[model samples]
Target: MSAPYAIPRSHADWRAMAESQSFETRAFIDDAFVDAASGETFETINPATGKVLARVASCDAADAEVAVHHARAAFDRGDWSRIAPGRRKKLLLRLADLMETHKHELALLDTLDMGKPVSSSLGDMAGAIACLRYNAESIDKVYGEVAPTGEDSLGLVLREPLGVVASIVPWNFPLMMTAWKIAPALAAGNSVILKPSEKSPLSALRLAQLAKEAGLPQGVFQVLPGFGHTVGKALALSMDVNCLAFTGSTAVGKQLMQYAGQSNLKRVYLECGGKSPNIVFADCKDLDAVAENAAAAIFHNQGEVCIAGSRLLVENAIREDFIERVLKAAEGMQPGDPLNPDSFMGAIVDQTQYQRILGYIRQGVEEGAHLRSGGESVETCPGGLFISPTIFDNVTPEMVIGREEVFGPVLSVFGFDTEEEAIRMANDSLYGLAAGLWSQDIDRIMRVTRRLESGQVYVNNWAGGDMTVPFGGVKQSGNGRDKSMHSLQEYSELKTVWMSLTS
Candidate 1:
C-alpha cells in the first residue's frame, strides 16, 4: 500500500497529464457504463479554465429507477449482501489496490474537475485509499454479540446490513468524502449507489469502473451522476433504498430528511454544514504556531471544506498580536494555477461558488466587518475561479458572514475578553461540526473544551486527525458520524435472535 504513483514535479508535467486525461463520463449501472435514459448529457467543466472537459450522462429519475432496480436485484440475490465477510473484504481491498494503482489519474481528474491544487488532490487521494483500506480491513474483524440469558434460553445480537444504500457526497473533497460513505456502507455488506455531486463527479465515475474491475458483483456498487433534485430525490424516495447517507449543505440535508419521511422512512445519515470556530486564548504558549494553524484551517483546499475553522475567536489579551500573525500567514496563501506544484491555494469550485464567496465578502464589508487582508479575486490564475484568501476582523455573532456557512476561504475574526466569552461566541452559530482551542492552561483547556458545542475539537491544533476518529456534528450540522467504527453502525441494523434451549 505504499504510494503507487510518482508525484508530478512540475506544472508542465501536471498540465500534460490533464491534457491527455480520458474520463469515463457515463452512468455506471449493473457493471456497465451506459448513456442516460433520455440521452441527455451535462458538461463537466474544468473550474480552473471554465472549459468543458467532458459530456457526462445527466441521469434523471428514470435512470435512478433503473439503477435502483439493478441494485435491488443484486441485493435480493445476495451477490454482495450475503457474501462471506472475508470475501467482501478481499473485494474491497482489491478495489483499494486498484484505486492506488490509478491514484495519479484520479488525482489529476479531481484537480481538473474541481480546481483544487494538484498536491491537495493527491493528498486527498491518499486519504481516500487509506479510508477504503481501513474499512475493508475492518469488515472481517467486527463480530456479533452473544447476549446473556438464562441457561434455558439463548440470545444473540446480530449486526446485519441495510438492503440498499444511497450515498450523496459533496463537491469539496470529492474523492475523500466518497470514500467516507461508500467504504463503510460497502464494508457493512450493503449494496451502495453513490450519487456524487454534479459539480465534481469524475472521480466517482472512475471509481465505479475500478469497483467493477475489482470483481464486485453486478449492481453491487453503482455510480449515478446527476443533479440532486431529480436523481438524488428519486433515490431518497426509492422504496428499495434502505439507508441514505449524505454529506453536503444543511438545507439539502433537511430536504433528504423530508424525502426519507415522505417515502419509505429510509434511515438518513447526514454530515452537513459547519461554521467551526477556532478559539485562541492568551495562555497559548506560542501565538506564532497558533496563527499558522489558524490560517491553514480556513485557507487549505481553497477553504472549501465542510469542517473548516472559519470562525476565529481571539482572547483580547493578545488579540492584536495574534491577528497580525494570522494575517501574515494568510498573505502566503494566494490562489494560483491548481496544476502548479507550489500553489498553496487554487480556484473556487465553479462560477456559482466563486460569485457566492465574493457576495459574502461584499456582505461582510457592507455589514461593517473590517476587511483586514484579502477580500477579492486574484488575477494570478487567469480564467480560473480564484478568490484571494479573505479575512474579516471585528466580526460580530449577529452578522450574516459570521452566522452563515460560506464554504470558502473567508475567515471571520471576533475578539473576546474572557474564556467564557470565547466559548459563547464559538457556540453561538447554528452549525457545530468542529471547533479548535489553543491554550496551555490544562484546567481552562478542559473546561472550555467541555463547553464547546462540536463533534470534534482540536486543542493546540486546527485540523489533524486520522480516519480512526469519528467525524460528524450536532444541531444543524446534521447527525451520524462518517469515519471509524461509528460509520459502520450507520449502514447496519441490529437484530436480536432468541432461542429456547429447553425445547
Candidate 2:
C-alpha cells in the first residue's frame, strides 16, 4: 500500500523468490504427507497479494479419527511415549536445529501465508526456535519428587506424559504458537496432533516435513489443517485425546471446554483473547519513549497479538500531549508489501478479518469516538486487503470499540484522573492476559504491578521480555500458562506412588 520508507527490495525480487519453491499442502499423518480420508482439499490464499498459495488437505471428522487412532496406537505402543526424557530432548533439539538452518525459507512461507512483514515472520521463527530449544533443554533438568513419609513406608510422585495431545493454534504467529504447544508436549513424551488454522497452514505443513527429517517417530507428530467447524470439533469431541491445548478466541475456548466435558473430560489448556491495557502516568520523564511504544504495541503485526495493548489508559494531565506523540509515532507504520523487509505493516489476513476490522472502526465512529489518525483504506495496494492504522480518542470504557477485541491496528484512548482510577479501568476488562505500566516513580510501579489483575505485567515498556517467561491470561482470557517451565506441566499428569518398606 503506502510505504513511508523506500523499498529495500524490489517487487520483482519477491516474485522470483516465491516462484523458486512450492509450499506444501497435504496433511502430514503417520510420518508422511497424505490425502484426507474424504479426499477433499481447500485452497489456502496468500493474504499479501490475494493469490491462492496451495490446496491444503481439507481434513474433517473422518480424518481427525484417522489421526487420533494413529496417535492412540503410537502412544499405546510406547515407542516414543515411554522413551527416556533425555532421548526425547535430544530429538527435539535436533528439530530445533533444523528449524534454525531453514529459517529464511520458513520466514518467507509465513509472510506469504499470512499478511505480515518478512521481518516480523523472522522474529516469529526465532521465537519458535527458542521455545523448542528451551523446552528441550529443560526436560532432563526437571525431576519427579520424592515425598516425605515414615521410615517404614515410601512415597514417590511421578510425572507421566498424557497419552495423546491435540494442539489447536491460531492463524497469527502460527509457527511460534505451534512450537509453544508441541515442544513441551513432545518433551513430555506424548503423541501430538497439531491442528493449524486453515487460513495460514503452509508453515505448519512444512514443519511436519522438518520434524520427519529430525526423525520424530511415525504417528508421534501429525499436522491436520482444516476448518474449525469440522476437524477442530472432531478433535474436541474425540475420547482418545488426553489433553487439548488451544490458542484462539474466548468463545472457541469455551466451546472446546464443553466438548472436552462431553467426551473424555480431557484436560484443557487455553490461551485466548485479550484487550490488554497499556497505562501511562504523567510520568517524571520520557513521554516521547512511552508514546512511541504505545503506538507500536497496537500497530505491530497489524495488532493481531492476543496480548496487544489495544486499550491505552493515559493520565488526564498528559492525555492530549501523549495522543499527539502517539499519532506522530504511527505515521511511519504504513501498510505495504509484506515481502519487503522494510515494510512496517502489511494487508489484513483475509476478507473476513478485513471486513471485521472495518466494522469495528465504523462502530467506533457511530459511538461518537473522535477519529484521531489514519482510518481509511490504502488505495495503492488494490488486490490486497490493506488498511491504514486507525486511532480513536475520547473513548469511554462503555463504547463498543473500547470493549471488544478488534484484532487490527486500531487503538482506543481512555483518560484517567488518578492512579486508582487507572488501575480500575485497566482491570475492568474481562480479559487479563497482559498489561503495561509506565512511570518514573518506583513506588507507583511497584504498587500498580502488584495491584494489576493481568497474568504478565510489563514495566516502563509494552510487551517487553522473551520466551523464557510464562505467558497466558486469567478469567475470560482463558486458563493455563504457556512459554515457560509452567507449560511442561500442561502436557503432563502427576501420579503419587506409595510403596511399603517391610522388614
Best by lDDT: 1
Whole-model lDDT per candidate: 0.91, 0.90
TM-score of 2: 0.97
> Residue-wise lDDT of candidate 1 within 424-492, one digit each (tens)?
888998899999988888999899989999989999887778989999999999998988988877788
RMSD after Cα superposition, model 1: 1.4
lDDT of 2: 0.90
- What is the number of backbone collisions in each predicted candidate, taken in the order shown? 0, 0
Candidate 1 is scored at a TM of 0.98
lDDT of 2 by residue, 1-503 (tens): 23222323565666567677588889998988998889899988888778888888999999999999999999988889888889998999999998988877787788888888888988999999999999999998888899899899899998999999999999889899999999999998899999999989999999999999999989999999999999999999999999999999999999999999999999999999999999999974988888989999999999888998999999999999999999999998988888877888987889899899999999999999999997777854658888899999999999999989999999999999999999999999999999999999999999999999999999988877776788999989989889888898788889999999987
- How far is 314's C-alpha from truth in model 1 (Å)? 0.5
Question: What stretches of model 2 exceed 4 Å from their correct place?
Answer: 1-14
RMSD of each: 1.4, 3.7
Q: Which ten residues in a row have the lowest lDDT in candidate 2?
A: 1-10
